[model samples]
Target chain A: MNAIIRSTARCLRAGAAAVYLPVRAGARVWSASPPRRLLCAAADLQKDLGAMVKKDKVVVFMKGTPAQPMCGFSNAVVQILRMHGVDQYAAYNVLDDGELREGVKVFSNWPTIPQVYFSGEFVGGCDILLQMHQNGDLVEELKKLGIHSALLNAEKESK
Target chain B: MAETADHIRDKLIEELAAVHVDVEDTSPNRCAASFKVLVVSSQFEGKPLLQRHRMVNTCLAEELKEIHALEQKTLTPEQWEKQKSQ
Candidate 1:
């Protein structure tokens, strides 16, 4: 498991490096900012994130994968999605990439992990998701995305 | 010194002008690394959920560095009253 995690981390880093190289090279030439390198790196990460969130209808950046969340908060997020029958979403394990873990916080301007995105829009963390779930806002939000939540079906079946 | 629930409560009350703040230390050993908080303030009025959370995050930026998990429920005073009545 450790080996697999390590390899995955390596691949992610390599992928980030591939994205970073071109930006760094381009910035080296004519970038006027005094902190040119830092700015370029931040911009590159943001660009990557901008694409990543939109790549799926739902995206979750959490402490662990949906199948096995490492933290209780992350577990709660996984559970909530599962309860809504939202199975086919992008889940990024922040534990694998320190840079991604930190970068996402800055990207979303959120301070915690287990950040949820719907249709590339920033949803709140576990607390907000729980609130939405309780208040029935999640069902409406899911419907907007054309997803018929399982809970809604279940409610109908029960009645 | 490690942060206590009262410390967080005081900070939120002060920084956000919170009318009601409840901070519970949920760490297994009372280590102060994890917390669950409910904050009610007029500052959260007219703000979306994410923005309200961001306000609390920014208010506790330094404390969050030492904390592990933070669960927040932010509401405007009116919302808080509604919830309480319910």
Candidate 2:
């Protein structure tokens, strides 16, 4: 039995009865009669969202607008990309959709934001982006797309 | 695939007499899968960010395990009002 007890009318579907498992707090979540089916379904949703991120060559899901990012991290990505001169990328703001905002997690298998997906692959977030930019790897990656990064010159003053 | 963000939201609604709360699932791109949360409570006036986040984390610890990211935007009703004013 699952130790921690809480109750709500859970929907396996909309207003449908699903397995009622005993989730004991200390015990394994589902040792007996697993909620595997429901979990798989949920996993599927997360998977789908993950797929969408990779669906584009470069997708930038951020806050506010790309022109004026609301968060520091978002701002950093915008700044770095501008420096890179890689002008074409998609930006989706989670702020607009409460469901997409909260439910996007299951899709990406990731947990943080300013999530950038590139070449239909999981590109790391802000820190990774900065690291890549510093190493010239980010520029090289963009050049693979036939876009030469102007960031090389931008780094001149800093260096 | 874990618990729905709504499940977390429901718990908050049950626990707090919340007029406004928002939960965002941010698992698509970072490590330690997380949910970006914005909660407006009359309960959180003088509390700092750490304390406010801790409250939500504690309330949803089980879900937190499944959930790797918790981006919280916690504000008091007064604070929220101030944002609106601005």
Candidate 3:
């Protein structure tokens, strides 16, 4: 049942990407003519990103989608989330959009890709995530969002 | 110009007053594009992980532009001691 929902979401995301890419490219081409037009685009991107982060409880702006990560750092994030049994998060592939790749860095005020957000708050990148996971903070964080980590049960059973 | 591990180490120590710094060029061919660093500083005492990272990011803003990857582990002096004891 959960898998079905996840696959459906994936399909929807893929469909959205198919439609969004060309439109974004067109906007870029149009904006190139005027200097002020570029500024407007940046403003619009910030507004869009403000909504994008909060759209899901867990949002990741990574180099690639969860299924197929283009970078090792991004792959590590996906694996950590998977270990916690978190499969229903939003993942954006920054590599697909040049604007997004640059926009997100400015939006988050962090000069790095593979950024993570929990409940619309910037949660640092791969290293911080790995630290949280190792130190048991990730499980607590997940619990706060009403998501019980699979590690909690595994630890109980092992004991 | 490409960033070097030694240059990064010096910058961290000077800018952040980092007491202990370990930087490794993790790129396969030693191209200096990728680095892994562990920084221990008194300045990180009260700050959270995100703030600590931001500090490093700001200090190395120029270097980061040319560098491809950076993996950082930041710690306060006390936390560094605790980890060392463990």
Candidate 4:
């Protein structure tokens, strides 16, 4: 009651613990709620994409894995790379993760599946790959990355 | 809401100050899910094809978030003029 206030002050002392307790406890109740679930979902997928790209000198985020490409465009890129003797590159199946499927487009800022990367850099998708192959630029690019293709010599011999 | 081909085209032209732009809705059902774009801008001069495409992608970032597919052929004004005359 007013006993503590009166005793401590010439007229008053501290109030009852009840008065300060509830207000201080309430203000100190900082819950620190967890981050939103939706953000984590996308963030995880983007982290996965980043890691996947970094793992290989050549990384393709396609609709399906190399063995069983689900999309024609993806299959086309896979075939082209194989023809160029790129046998050990990594390929991520965007279809497996819904977040990955969408996150990749944002990650590359290119609105297409079958996106390609070289040395952790965003290479274009199927069309650019095909064009580069036709122009004999793909072979040179791969060579710069320490990837060799006997097919380049074979094509020259055939020509 | 979904954006139309004309809307995307106008936005690209406005943003890039492109000399020429053609936006085509390539969706099988014409639902605006896919688009093919050919843009000619002096701003693209000296940029590699990847960088040129990147420029277009950046300009249409908002539209791209909603659209499912995009194919781009970016060219400088001189390249565009050469192709046209050819």
Candidate 5:
């Protein structure tokens, strides 16, 4: 049943892509002369992205791992989540998997990397996270996930 | 090839009824691969940040195929007015 639902979702996504992004639909972004690795790593990326998103309450498909992020944008997101008292989230390094990297963009229907998901729901990337943090929405969202932000709690207690 | 910043700017103004739109190419060497966009529109008044980004993303779905990266700051007309003053 789960597999059936997943395939149906994939079909719907493909349909939407054709209708929405007709120019780039069904075409993988490859070099002028595509490398062997790029062509060969065409794994089932939709399944991989889905598994990763469902793997944890919070998941970040970023350029590098949390300890050492490759990009400034990814690093910024990691730091913000840390400041919010989050330390346990799944992080996938897209740099390691070409297929995963391209698949992720398609899966999220988002152009950038360092995408964040909360409880299987797609959240926005760096800018959105920053805005949520600034407006105190991140704290509330974390609370709903049963993850408490120590910094937020401290601020509350001081008031 | 992706559309130019001017094209994106004009499209956003037309589609989103944007009051202010700034699309800057942020890639190295001034390439059009990446962009930073700030859009102010009355349409975003009641939407959350995620939805606002989604709206912008959807608006530029075709352009996004060639534009490798995009960082967006979406704001409402009232918020944009406040930002301008400050």
Candidate 6:
């Protein structure tokens, strides 16, 4: 099953324009050439996205809703995002979308959900995100974007 | 008297009159409960994957609050026969 999940995992290939989509199970990782078009306007989620992206600087879409994560992988991503003090991002439950979950891989050209988009740019999955946090790079990247890297609390100001 | 995978399985067998069904418990994961399923039924013929899975999900909807992940490998009886060739 673990093999089933990873072979299905979509991620940006190192120095590759097309994403590697796993097909015929783990035995094959098909190279799917992604269309080179930035058609955010064509995005199915475009209708409410004006409200969606503006509502949250960071957004996560995954298999289960945040309150109850259906998989261990999903929960791991949520934990890492929280650890970065980024509790404000919106989360869309991908179990709601057959297209978005699969399409998101094509949309972002990266497979896997519990996916993170910062200011609408694909920021990678749990493994990549956690790696960034450990390397002290995620904080700087978010700061550069003027996005809060972690959940900022009010009480800390008085201290 | 209480709920078990076997209890759910029996209910599904009765409800769908299915030809085959397999259920496995995977509750060790931190969320609620999880079950791995492979079901074959004549009723599921011509259905999409999601719909087939949803049928199983809906059949056990009330029971699903206890089940978080349902890894399904649903098939029509015909599809199962085709898979048997592999």
Best-performing candidate as measured by TM-score:
3
Report the C-alpha lDDT of model 5 over B4-44, residue by residue, as the tens digit. Answer: 99999999999999999999999997889889999999999
Prediction-by-prediction clash tally:
0, 27, 0, 5, 0, 6
Models 1 onward score TM values of 0.82, 0.45, 0.84, 0.74, 0.77, 0.41
Candidate 3 residue B51 C-alpha distance from true site, Å: 0.9
> Per-candidate DockQ versus the true complex?
0.69, 0.08, 0.78, 0.59, 0.59, 0.02
Name the candidate, 1 or 5, with the larger TM-score value: 1
Top candidate when judged by DockQ against the true structure? 3
lDDT of 5 at A158: 97
Residue lDDT tens for model 1, B1-86: 68889989999999999999999999999899999999999999899888999999999999998998898999899999998999
Clashes of 6: 6
Per-residue alpha-carbon lDDT of candidate 1 for residues A17-61, written as tens digits (9 for 90 to 100): 433211111112323221112223446667778777776678888
B5-59 in candidate 2: lDDT tens per residue?
A: 6877888767755568887777765333567767888777686544565566667
Summing lDDT over every window of 10 consecutive residues in candidate 1 chain A, give the lowest-scoring window.
A19-28
Model 3 per-residue lDDT tens digits across residues A1-159: 997886566455544542222111011232221111123335766777777777667888888777788999999999999999888777778998776788899999988889999998999999999999999999999998899999998989999
Question: What 10-residue stretch in candidate 6 chain B is worst by lDDT?
Answer: B28-37
- Report clash pairs, candidate 3: none
Find the candidate with the highest lDDT and give its number. 3
Q: How would you encode candidate 2's per-residue C-alpha lDDT over A7-121 as one tens digit per residue? A: 1222233125332222121222323332222432445445545555555456677766677687777788878887787656666677764434555644554445667777766
How would the docking of model 6 be graded?
Answer: incorrect
Q: Write the per-residue lDDT of candidate 4 for residues B1-86, one digit (tens) a residue.
A: 78798998898899998988999998889999888899989999888888888888788888878887787888889988888999
The reply for model 3, stretches above 4 Å from the true place, is A1-40
Model 6 earns a TM-score of 0.41
Give a tens-digit lDDT track for model 6, residues A53-93.
Answer: 34445767776766677767678777776676555556667
Write the number of the candidate with greater DockQ, choosing between 5 and 6. Answer: 5
